[model samples]
Target: MFWVVAAASAVVLGVAATLAVVFWPKYPALAFQPLADPSRVAPAVPITSRFAAATVRGDRAYFASVSDDGTLGVVAADTGTGERLWGNPAAGDADDWQQLVALPDAVVAVSAEDDDRRRMVLLDPGSGKPLWDRVIGDDDTLLYAEDTVVLVDREEDRLLGLDVRGQGRVRWELKDPGSLSGSRTTTVLAATTPEDLAAPTSAKGAPFAEPLDDDRRIVQIGADRSARVIDARTGAVLVPPRQSVADPDDPVVAHDGTLVVAESDNARRIVAYDLAKLGEPRVLYTAPDDNTRFEHLTPCGTDRVCAVQTTSSDAKTAQVVAVDVAEGGRRWAWPLPDTNNLVPVGDSLLAAQNTTPAKVSLLGADGTVRWTRDGVAARLDGGNLLRFAKPLSTYTDDPSVAGEHLGDDAVELGPLSGVRPATCAWNTAVLACVADEDFVLRRFAG
Candidate 1:
């Protein structure tokens, strides 16, 4: 009886050992602690009022916005601070304001009553204190690059480039300035006509949109739709041949020195101009149908172009295609429904609906829909759709009404231009222009 009892005890011990060995946790054990109740998960904190524009700076977020009456407010916060950051630090009323641009060392707040009375105010992100304020060009033509700002004299047809720091002299002004726009890292200033215009014409009538490559050379888009690569310091034209641009209205320069232009003339083709081999055109496909009209073309990294094709018969449906600019071939194509407008959001595409603002959907290079956000619009960086809830009293108004149109009375925030950038910082997954009443600087999962 004693041996049987001992043998049974040993059998039980062996079974227990086997169970423990099979179910043992690894080096990183299951250290998770359950909440008091199964339903007691942490609640999501949604963004709220008083924050303006939220831009990424290094690892933290820097947000800026206007108050009830055009006052400037700036705040900085980190994701480590639970779901939200500390409140804003800078707040004050201004008569009129332009846009907030992020610089390498500081943020620039441009305000003006008019172009002749424009002010470029620099602020330190840490303190939101005013570094310096200077009068730039007249209000009619104020353009911003990363660190540089260009002021154009509309009446005189001249260009003045200023370093926002106020410590350096203004760079050389183009005597016969044409059309210009600012990129994320560089400035594009093209001299279209040497002679001054009696009346302002559309920017398309102006000459090339040159990529101001650093401070060394100013790349030109020539009269024949060619790229005139010029030495920035010496003013010598490098390549003089005109490129066969498909869509002059929508042109993008790739990293490999290839120029991709939308074939607006032919909605089915994208014409590529190689800077290395000028005068040659590479053709890319858009859709099977020829009558389809192509609108927006966002670049995919340094090579491919994201094409948004529109059909006049079906206003709601859009055909999106990916084109390899170098090889001049179609990568893939897919049809998306209920899209009013198309914009680039991070690495994916955003669909702006006329009835319901805008939302994002991640589109892969192989034409796959990865993720999507439904019924939310505010890709504010492209400058479309003002964050203000109420429509502006007029397009020329200084400040906007927040929650006014959507049923609240808060300060107005923008007369925001309807332009979006091709690329944004890596940390920024989605950017939205929300009504100022619903303003806060916070992070959300992509």
Candidate 2:
């Protein structure tokens, strides 16, 4: 009788454990903690006086700035120790070092001088030694991905692909020209074919097709709202220029190589073009006409993309919705008030609010808020970590300081008295900031 009772109790406990495991809600593994004291924050090598732009690749931080003497330059520094690695003091006569493309082994600096001459300089990442420099016409645009450098030459009406590490050897050139109509902005999106996506893995764990010379495609969107898709290897026109849209904003490549374009017509809708068949694009999804507008679209996960939708012209009232790019359906939607930006941080999304009493919220993939921190202006670093700041006062004459926080912790870094907004760059291991007259770089404590 005792053995029979024990057996029955064991079976009941097993059933209860199974039910708990099956019904439990799973959440992302992300947490926020208070930052350390500001006085303890370390400093990295001082960059040029006025910082224009900065980006991090690997362990180096590349910055474009104008010196106190009014000269434009590019500087590379060790992100960990604030040590100066290389400096280009005379990048250009004009103070327009617009873009820096950082790769694993090289950094390409793009500069437009006063003569409208565009220059592309490839430098060794470690030594800062110039590998090669090329001068292209002012109308040309440069884009880099993996080991290939793509140049959209508007003057010649051609798209050129060259080996990134080679001596400017042309891999292929395709002629697909369209006018920008004085529009200054153009975007190039690189994608792989469906077969390449499913190719066997190489020894390095990347898809075997990734290293193939001819497996990529380039989609170029001009300022005039015209777009073209070109084969990267043979310069073949996969999709011609006639597939232009009337109102095109953000063009993102889906995982399956579909070019997704958000078009705002009488009604806002998402149109997708299969790169394999650049014919008539199919409407992926459409927004119901209720003052609805789609602002931006970004990758959410493997199968879906997130779109920031605003009900009115006021950006302060916005909601993020995840849409299935392949199946054409809404997955989830989350409301965010006063949203300044929506950045994907790790497996979560960080919604930064721009209004008074600024707040940052971490959102899960399932549209749940994991945590929220107030009284801070936050931005995502290159590594997707959060860097926060709080202004001391609005009065410029006041000597009040802006408090800086590395994470969600309460510990403040040494305050920057009199600096209203401090520009910063951070990775998982280090935080570099320019506050008032100081450029400080501090390491993260384990």
Candidate 3:
């Protein structure tokens, strides 16, 4: 009887040990660590208001609150103390604060005054006090901003550089600048017509959508196909305007401090001209064959640019080839046929697949595929790796985001089961999401 009792006890202990080993927390190294909880700050947004949007600037998180009275309020929350301030920082009494853009020390809130006029308000991060308010044309868009200058498209025909420090004053205006959008990391923006911004087939769409290697110079193209590179900071013309572009296939791209334009005489040849002197066109890359074409010319790393080469044959194969900008030769090639976008996260690359199920791969600096996750949609936003279990559908489903710092081995992004990440906004410092009409702020420890 003693022996039987001992054997039963040992069996129960063994089973418990096995369960613990198998059920250990997974993805603990790939997630975010929340610094606050619901009980601390409780809800970041008030219960009386619906959480419309949220953004993080500096050390504070801003929330857009919509009340039943049909008024929108900009609320601030202290990330350090988990304190949601009562001051609703705003300028005009616009009905909707449609967008919030975070800068170094201020937050810019854009609201539509009417169908013909749009208002932009720059607010202080601490007290939500108004620093500047400017009413722009309805056709104008807040294209790109850096430091103190906010670049905008004026009346769909010009570039307006507004000084944030000067209360949205027009520091510089470039008339007839054509359609120009700013790059995220670089000042080199593609100059195109207003119509090309909406059409991809025109070879003028998504110029500012990709990251650039440098920001010292900006590339501007005219409607007449003339291209030039200018000083990004001062808007001083560096390369004289020349009809250097070939056709729709060969566009002028600012890369590696050089103007990468196609040889005007030979549409098939591509060259890079140094910004110091537009002396001679250095051969950067050329068409591998007539049947293959390159798409999405992006800067993958320092002194390196990559493009997706797709074969037009029956097989329809695609591969990414990285070009050594210095050597003017191929560095490495990786076969990722259905690649949707090659997003640069710090020094690594987050390769997203355009397939139905969505295969996401984290590629190392040397083009090595470190890890790949299937059946999940992924995005690099605010320099954070955001992921969804399935395709996000706001109409039919409530999608949640599981995110983490791209380079760190952090596991999970706080406790985000009830939060809506689609409407959430994040920066390098903080993440703000909504849960059941309230705002949820999650911070990361560096």
lDDT of 1 by residue, 223-310 (tens): 2343544444333455653544432244444334555666545555677665554556667765567767666555553367776677
TM-score order of candidates, top first: 3, 2, 1
lDDT of each residue in 1-446, candidate 3, tens digit only? 99999999999999999998898432223335544454123332243433266665545667665554435567677766657774563454565556766565567777755778877778776677888887777656554434344354545555566666677677665644324533211122643222222111100112212221125455655554556655544556667766544342353556445666544343344567675566667787776666666666665566676666676622237676677777797777788868756655434566667777767777767777877776343333323465555543322234444555555553444334455444555543355665555667666444
- Could you give the C-alpha RMSD of every candidate to the true structure, in order shown? 14.4, 8.9, 12.2
- The positional error of residue 208 in candidate 3, measured at the CA in angstroms, is 15
Q: Per-candidate TM vs. native?
A: 0.55, 0.67, 0.69
- Order of the predicted models by lDDT, top scorer first: 2, 3, 1
Q: Is candidate 1 or candidate 3 better by lDDT?
A: 3
Provide backbone clash counts, one per model. Answer: 20, 14, 12
Q: Write the per-residue lDDT of candidate 2 for residues 204-292, one digit (tens) a residue.
A: 11221223333566777666666777766556778777446533346355445677777766657777777666678777778877577
lDDT (Cα atoms) of all candidates against the true structure: 0.44, 0.56, 0.55
Q: Report model 2's TM-score to 2 decimal places.
A: 0.67
In terms of lDDT, the best-performing candidate is 2
